[model samples]
Each structure stands twice: as C-alpha cells, then as structure tokens.
Target: MPPAQNTAGPGREVLTSDDIDRALRRIAHEILEANKGPEHLVLLGIPTRGAHLARRLADALERVEGTEVPVGSLDVTMYRDDLRSQPTRAVEPTVVPPGGVDDKVVVLVDDVLYSGRTVRAALDALSDLGRPRAVRLAVLVDRGHRELPVRADYVGKNLPTSTAERVMVRLAEHDGEGTEGVRIAGPAEVAP
Candidate 1:
C-alpha cells in the first residue's frame, strides 16, 4: 500500500479531558435510559483503551444509578480478519463478568470507531461466548469511513476525517501521555 497523506498538521487536539469526561457522562445516561435501568447490562471493552473507557463508563453509571455495572475486556485478536497479514500481537485476556453475555444487553465499548473492522471482529468473538438479548456499541470518537456496516449506538463525538488521517486517543490511564484527549494526526510515511 502507498503511504497515507497526513490531513492534520502534525497532531491536533480534538477533545480535552473535560470533553471526554462529559461525553462519557452523557453516554452513561443514554445507556441507562435505553436499557430502562442497568439490570442485565454488560459493558465489554475492546482491549487496551476500550477497557479503560469501559471502566470509566461503569464508574459513571455507578454514580448515577448507584448500581455496580459489570465491566470486562474482550480480546478479538484471534477473531480479526487481518490476523494472517499482521505481525503476531500479544493476545489480551477476555474477561467476561460472572454473568455471561446470555440474555444480557452487551455494550461493546471502544475508543474510536474508524473502519469498523475492530467492531466486526468483536462481534465474531462475542458469538463464541453466549448470546446476548441485544448488542450495542459505544464509542468515544466516531471517525467516519466504515468498511463494515457497523454503527455506534452511543457516540461521544462524531469526527469526520480523510482516509489519510489517523485518530489517536490518549488517556491518562493507558497512554500515560500526560494528557487525556483525542488527536488527529497525519499518517506516518514508510520508507521505500
């Protein structure tokens, strides 16, 4: 593949810490409202950053509903369609709450919704588990350009970008990048 063109100058901040917090708060409320309470609701993070976002959302839900939300991590490494072409990646642990996905409202959480490939792989991984009454998607940033027909049920922000640009989500918990925010950066050039 040819090198991707950078759309944004270097790295441009799209969301700050406060913005992220507010977005999560709104998403938490929306999740609660849609589910008609937190009963049988499961927040499954899609490894790495998604796991952190899930925990944050769970905390927000707990604060509002005064009920503990089941937060876990889902690793879709084996289920990824491009696994054969990519380098070997360390598989993260898939931790489902004591109550499996069966009959529960499973909310797949992720940091960014880019090509929708990750979400597709997540669905494939989830099928191996139990069947959920319903499956919803929650994403902090929805950068349009989906290769699959997947959409986020709860979105914090809708950021439109070109195929050459990349969205980078930096969280204090995972990134340790001294700031919690979202940035749009130009793609890195590969040497010929």
Candidate 2:
C-alpha cells in the first residue's frame, strides 16, 4: 500500500496529538501495572508508521515508569501479498537487532488497526527473528473488521468505519515537520 497521507475528509478528528499523548500515558500506566515494570519488555514496532508509534510509546513508558525500554522496528512488506496494490515502489526496509527476541516480552505497536493483515504479517516476520516468551500488541486506533483473529492488548481508540471509508494515521515521526495523529477520508477521495 502507498504511505498513508495527512489529509481530512468527513467525521471529526478521531485522534489528535493530545489524544495520542493521553492514550500513550494511559497505556504506559497499564503496561507498567500489568507487567509489573518496564524491565525485560522489548518494544518492536511494525515498520513504516508502527515504528514511529512504538518510539513515542516507549518514551512515554520510560518517562512514566523510570525505566529504559528498548524499541525496535520490523518491516513486513515482503510478507504482505498485496504488493501489486501497493504504491509504485516498495516500502522501507525492515530492521531488527542482532540479539534476537529470545524470551522477551514483545509489544508490537502500530498506527491504524484495520483488517489485522499487517499484524499477521508482522507475526510471520517475527518468527524468523527468534522466540519471544510472549507477544502483545498496541494499536493507536482499532477500526474493527479484522481479517485475522489478531487483537491489540493496548488500544488508544476504537473507531467504527465503513468499507467505503479510509482511515489514515499520521505520525510526526513519519509525516515530520509538524504533522501527526489519525484521520479518515471518504471512499471517493482516496485511491481505490
């Protein structure tokens, strides 16, 4: 798929930076509370947008819990089947640490939770990395309609969208220069 753009259509802003900050703060509290601490928790973001979200979440978690969290990014472009439907060019590179994921609590972060295909691909990509003791997921927006049984452990927001609508997530890390958050566009306005 082409990189998601920063634009507006209908409906209000489902998630703004303020919204994202609040969500991250809350999720950080939840993660610390559930995991007992930030120790042994390795955060891996599904590349492109997910990696960016993961970094933000890691910082929040670190600030809230006073622990250093290792954050990494994984690119699952090769694992995706819709290369033809993607942009004219392929996606960015996938990078993982040499240490591997042995017996670590992996929290996968992503921007928009759509059909769960990306999460599925991430799982496949992760298998080659190594064995993590357990895997968890954190999505900025959960837009329902999952093609896979995948679910996020920490969700910032839950949005109900139609098949005709498009959900776009913009992160300052990716969009850069002062743009961020998530928005949805009408079917006709987006490339089908």
Best by TM-score: 1
lDDT of each: 0.92, 0.82
Off by over 4 Å in 1: 1-10, 188-192
TM-score, candidate number 1: 0.91
* Per-prediction TM-score: 0.91, 0.87
- Model 2: ten consecutive residues of lowest lDDT: 4-13
Please provide, for model 2 over 22-92, each residue's C-alpha lDDT reduced to its tens digit, 9 standing for 90 to 100.
99888888888888898778888887788888888889998987788888898888887676698464567
Q: Which regions of candidate 2 fall more than 4 Å away from where they truly are?
A: 1-11, 84-89
lDDT of 1 by residue, 1-192 (tens): 999864432478899889999999999999999999999999999989999999999999999999999999999999998898995877999999988999999999999999899999999999999899999999999999999999999999999999988888889998675667888877663212
What clash pairs does model 2 have?
A: none
Error of 2 at 28 (Å): 1.3
Query: Which candidate leads in lDDT?
Result: 1
